[model samples]
Target: MNYFGIIRPAMVTCLMLMLYLAIVVVSLITGPSGLDPQLLSGFSLSPVTGDSEMANVIVTWLLLPRTLMALLCGAALGAAGVLIQGATRNPFASPATLGVNAGAMLAIVLGSVFLPQFTGQFPVVVAFSGAILTTILVFRLAQAISDSPVNLVLIGMAMTLSLGALSAGMLMFYENRLDGLYTWGAGNLSQFDYQPIQRSWPIIGMLTALALLFARRLDMIELGTEQAESLGVNVRRTVGLSLLIAVLLSSTVVSQVGMISFVGLIAPHIARGLGCRKVWLRLLVSTAVGALLLLVADVAARLIPLLISDSHYSFPAGVMTTVVGAPFMLFLLTQRKRVSALATTPGETGIQALFHLSPVTFLSALAFVFLLIFGFSLFGNLDLQWINLRWPRVLSAAFAGAALGVSGLVLQTLTRNPLSSPDVSGLTTTGVLFVVLGLVLFPGLGSLEMTLLSIMGSGFALLLLLGLSRLTGFNPLLFALAGLCLSAMAATLISMVLVLGSNQSSEVLVWLSGSTYAVTSERFYLLFISVLAVLPLLFAMWRRLDILQLGEYLPSLLGVRIQATVAILLVMVALLSAVSVAAVGGISFIGLMAPHICRVTGLSSHRHLIPATAMMGSILLVGSDWLSRTVIAPFEIPSGLLVSGAGGIYFILLLLSGKYIQRR
Candidate 1:
């Protein structure tokens, strides 16, 4: 390396170390109890003696431990980030992006709920187990989808959402029992004593050292598997070791600190941006940078309580990380040097090519739908009389699923990208956010009023996605990134509202989870009528969709009103998405899955694709709803979760099939 390269990185590292120390001092002095300037006068004496005794007590018991824990956790995260980014060969890779933190949080929450005794004592083990499982799942899914960074991150995002939903559902279900879990879930850095620090530091120190040992191998692996292998590196073992170290470091912090967001992601990136590309130097700089970033965030978390004048409203340090991290992620997305387009083959075909849907097949599909409705509605019910009352539930599931399926089909067609869907494109989250906003701003707002706001929100989100995609050239990865960013923003907004409006949050949570249990006749008709009117309109525009499918320029050459046609269809998608969100509360992936399945089955024509997708969607959601109701009988799970989880898995399968992997 050049002298300047070494000197520059070393200088940055030193500066960062100094900055971290400065923050540590600041954190040590400031607390809920005001800092005393006179405490500095007693530096000559023992810490526990002299005029600084009270100051020593405050620093020793409270600030000292918390600050130390932050430093340790931040350093671990920074090292883990470098390891993950190196192992994945993706600059964007981090603990959060790989679903490690979410997985760890899920395990921790579940343990606290079901295995309370063991969790309180062995949280780190439980957390590590969860993180390991999640890491494996993410890697498996990424392997299936292609080792492309975008694909891995996409799968990771799906995993994060699925795991997060599971955690949220569990927490909501046991809301009464899990009193302190919420604050912990948000990742508080407050320390009553030094127990966490005492228990945590040794493990962190060892892991950091282990990570450094892997630095040279990681650098080789970054050269590509073939190159690394040629250079006498065992690529698989290195990757495995790297991932294990990364997961352990990250999960350890999560176990102790709840969930510190973005430290892993930003630390390594900042180090690399500052010209620290050599593995060892980058690791050191990243560690210091992470410590500084987190210490600053913790300080802000402490000071914000003072600014707000409400100690009860103290912002969790984790929340602040996300607040900073999300926009940074978005900026990184826009900065991606290149992205591969989804693969296209002439005359695409799916399972439908093997078995033609004759009149009998149509009848069979219809019979199956009715049977699903019956199975979901009447099966195992002690009260047969209540079968009549279940029609609303059945209809609600069918209507919402059908709407989402058709919406997904419309989005895929309009975008000419199979990965495009209402949920993935962010319409569903936007709609849910709008409804939540309505509920917060107007507590007495009826379903009708909320539905209107949802439609507006979905439309706005769609427009925003389109605008951003225009800038990104409609690259599927960028599109998904935009959607994820929008979703995160919406989720953050919902979290804030929930924290502020604690009393009514449960009702909002239920709606966001996409439950069918609350389907009243009014809501049922609203969704049912909306689907009935829109499905036929969708059919009428099938020819236009087909024409547009020929390519944008060709369609215009063929006299298709491209702009007006796209605008109308997209509006229809927004409407359908809003209706589904209104009825089922952000049911996702159904819109992505149903149409994808149909297209894979060789139904390429819009005529076949749209209706087939709608039918499949109806089946998927009805079945999901059935599972939701019966999975833990008498206590329903949200159909949305089942659909989202299944769809995410199916999407991964498609990626794993190797057809989607673009050769450079």
Candidate 2:
């Protein structure tokens, strides 16, 4: 290797080692007052004697395990990221991307609620099993639709959301266990029980070792399966082995550390960029980097003083990653060379041959709408009888869904990427956080303030996103990727509001699942105002949105003021999205699904698609909400989870089927 490569690897390794030592030191140093035997006395000055009696006792009994858990868990994640990315041959890949973490988390949450017995005996086992099953299902579903690896990941994502909803449904039935579920969901290291370590090591070790051994082959796979096969590599075996490795590696890590984000997503990429291409180097470098990053992140999670001059400032490490990692990922996407993410539909089927109503689409959609209304009737606590106001719930759901549908449609059109929606873009999460923060800081900010602040936050996030793209010279695909990361981060940071909040916050989490729950007349009025506002703007720029989808140069050549048009459209989206988030907490997949359904069904024209999407969105939240509440009679699933369950699966189906292959 060249001097730069050699020096770079060494530098990172040294830094990682230093951080590792630092973690050991910190863990050894800090503890509760009366816990350590030697430190219990409050002072000590003997080498082995006092250290062992006090710090060692604390370390061995307390911090040692935590530190080791951090190291091992982080290492496993780093390796897993490399394995999955190499296998999928996509840069924008993560376990979360395929819904593995979401599904596993959902399962864990449900188990805590419905199957508390399992939580005691086989929590990790159940989580691993759930993750493995979902991964396989997503893989199979994707392969069945389209055998492309990238599409497989997308399908896997769909599976994640689908399973996530089912898991949510289970949680809804067992809301008594909601507190524990949320705590576990954060991937916190506070669960320092030692038995989990024994249960965990065997699986993590085997998979990580296997991955390391086959790291060279993985690098080959990264080179391109066809090319690797040309060089006498068994493409099928390599792919299988790589995927199996990923499953085991990730599952093992989840079983222990819960689900830490971005370690797997970013570690390997950074490792390779730092010149760890060879299996041995990549494995070691990634492990080192992972350990270092997680340790620091853990420390950051603990140490970053919430200096909010505001009333209640709370922070969590998991949230920190999203806040930090989201922007970092975006920056990475910006810095890296941009590639066309415009995957076209395969087989040259235009609106002519493939103009079908999206298989299982209409039924699923209608059923979802009907069930949401039905659900509204069942759920009641004290004076709150959900079933009584079915019409109001439907009305509320309709407006919220319409707003999201319009938001997603505009995002897709302006960005020209089907995946470009508020949820994916972090716009919704940012707006919601703004609302929550406002509530936290200044107690009685009326609904108007909430709406206005939501709009402002969304606008700021959008502006930063657009400006960042320009500064970094990133393409649309990368820009969207960055947005997703930021959104993920925002979601993480904002979750603290739920976790640390009083009963009111708990109510928000339960109700925010994109369902038609408690919508009164006033909220509907605001939503109506949002709808009317967007309509006129959309009407004026009818044709331009269509051409914008063609690409950057084509629209500009067609006399479109791309920048000005995009900015105006973004303002409309923010107004709509702010209204949506304010009305119905942050929902996922509706925007993505509506547009996809329209496109797949040959309703590509902006004129028809926009209105149709509005209808689709309205139908979706209402139907989904109905089913969510009525599914189990007494308890109700949130509309968000229900939609994610079904819609997520359908999304994966599209991804795997190569439905968008060259079709964009």
Candidate 3:
């Protein structure tokens, strides 16, 4: 009767274990065939031969491995989250946020495409190698910029986007050979045998053990580096080793289960909330929590069809995790007391002073555009028929890119954050999500219908982002973080829709990847009209943007209506982004890159910046479209993927340059 205080931790652990066991049972019995009473009786280690043989086989070979894999992967990811957060002294750190998962995914895709023999035999090794390399790259870049948590996460996100785009490009190129990988890429837990589970569990266990061994050191390190070093803990060594173990654990799971988002992130918080204070206890609780979360998600993934009679597709467990986990991430952001904000006048004076306006630069940009146009027009042959086919795509790319450029410029000025862009701010992805949903619901949605859906989605996303970030006064880094969460959710929803709409999946995938393959004169005209319609409104706001750049307080003092101006600018951005995305799918980075390119060229005036950015964006996308068509010839890469890959690299470089680093 007096055991409550004496065995609280044990009691909690036991309760969680019981819950996990119940869920495991549910997972076993719930699936397409529904609950089988025979499974309960016939479930045995050894093969059963009788009326219950089928149940025994299903339980033994199918359900057991899948259920066990989910448990093990969740435990590993949860432990990895604890290790990473402990090492970084930042609660936001996780494998998915730190580029580890993306790197592992890219490695697997590369191995599958280039070295199938080796990759097939040693997928874990490939994933680990990729994870380690990307982790190193992210850490190095983040350290070089600043030691802020926001910087680390932003740099990690940059690398993740770049790696993800590269992986997508490869997947698109080799879709025929890697047909089944699309589902696996979304994080599947289906298993026919125990081989993968057997291979993964031992490695996960060993790495997790190593992580637990560092518990005391991590606890000390969390006290602060100076104190930890004074206490005889090699702070650097502990952090590095902890991160290494985290990567190993995460990569091990990814190698088996593909990319499961947010388990690592969600579990540690749950453990802490459950009153696990000490590092060791927290790690253990986090392990349990992660397992429970993943198991529950997997069970939900399995039970959806049973619960919904018309549902035919079983969504990947990863999508379910994101559906649940993204909100958690946003909640964490809202709880933060302070987030690093970008400097009000980001490179306004310094950039302008360092690089004055040069006609040569402008002329060079123009020449490049003309050159790309020439190449596009005459790349394959000098035939008029080829010219007629290529012109619409080239023009569509130019108009869409211009719209994105102006949109990005407006957003950057509005938020006073150099990193603000339609794609990064969730506008493009949300727009694409709605467009895809429309396609799924209506199947043959016309241009006007798609554009309307895109506009509605983008507007909703903008409002949601603005509302969520308002809690922190719209701090730039937190705003970006919030947008990233929205983007992830939209992407997961898009994936689910694509999975469910199998008939339109391929076509939608191509469009979602930002293809210009289907561009025609009609589509080109729609893009042109949309871009032209928005340009005048944007130009009229240039003066407001310039004044707003001086900072919100100054702008208000100067009689500028900050809220009204921002509201107007955001509506314009949403419109531009919606139209562009409708025309070219969810192309990323043009909005981010074009305006930055303009700033780098010493054009600080909004008047000049807006036009120059539009032109630069047009040049960039037109050039990308040309490369997409010519690089692999008959098989084209998606222009959006190309821009994303290039833009990701640029973003990392921008961080490395320390241009965006604002010292608190």
Cα RMSD of all models vs. native, in order, equals 4.3, 5.4, 2.8
Reference-based lDDT, each prediction: 0.77, 0.66, 0.83
Predicted model with the maximum lDDT? 3
Candidate 3 off by > 4 Å: 1-4, 7-11, 44-51, 305-312, 338-354, 359-382, 658-664
Model 1 is weakest, by summed lDDT over 10 consecutive residues, at 343-352
Winning candidate number (TM-score): 3
Better candidate by lDDT, 2 or 3: 3
The local lDDT score (0 to 100) that residue 500 gets in candidate 2 is 48
Off by over 4 Å in 2: 1-15, 32-58, 109-125, 137-169, 177-179, 191-193, 222-227, 305-317, 338-392, 468-476, 499-504, 549-554, 598-601, 628-636, 653-661
lDDT per residue for candidate 2 within 245-268, as digits (tens), equals 776667666655566777777777
lDDT of 3: 0.83
For 408-505, candidate 1 gives per-residue lDDT tens digits of: 88876665556667877788988998898788767877768877989999989988878877666666556776777677667666676666566677
- Higher lDDT: candidate 1 or 2? 1
Worst 10 residues of 2 by lDDT: 344-353
**Residue 664's lDDT in candidate 1:** 28
CA shift of 467, model 3, Å: 0.4
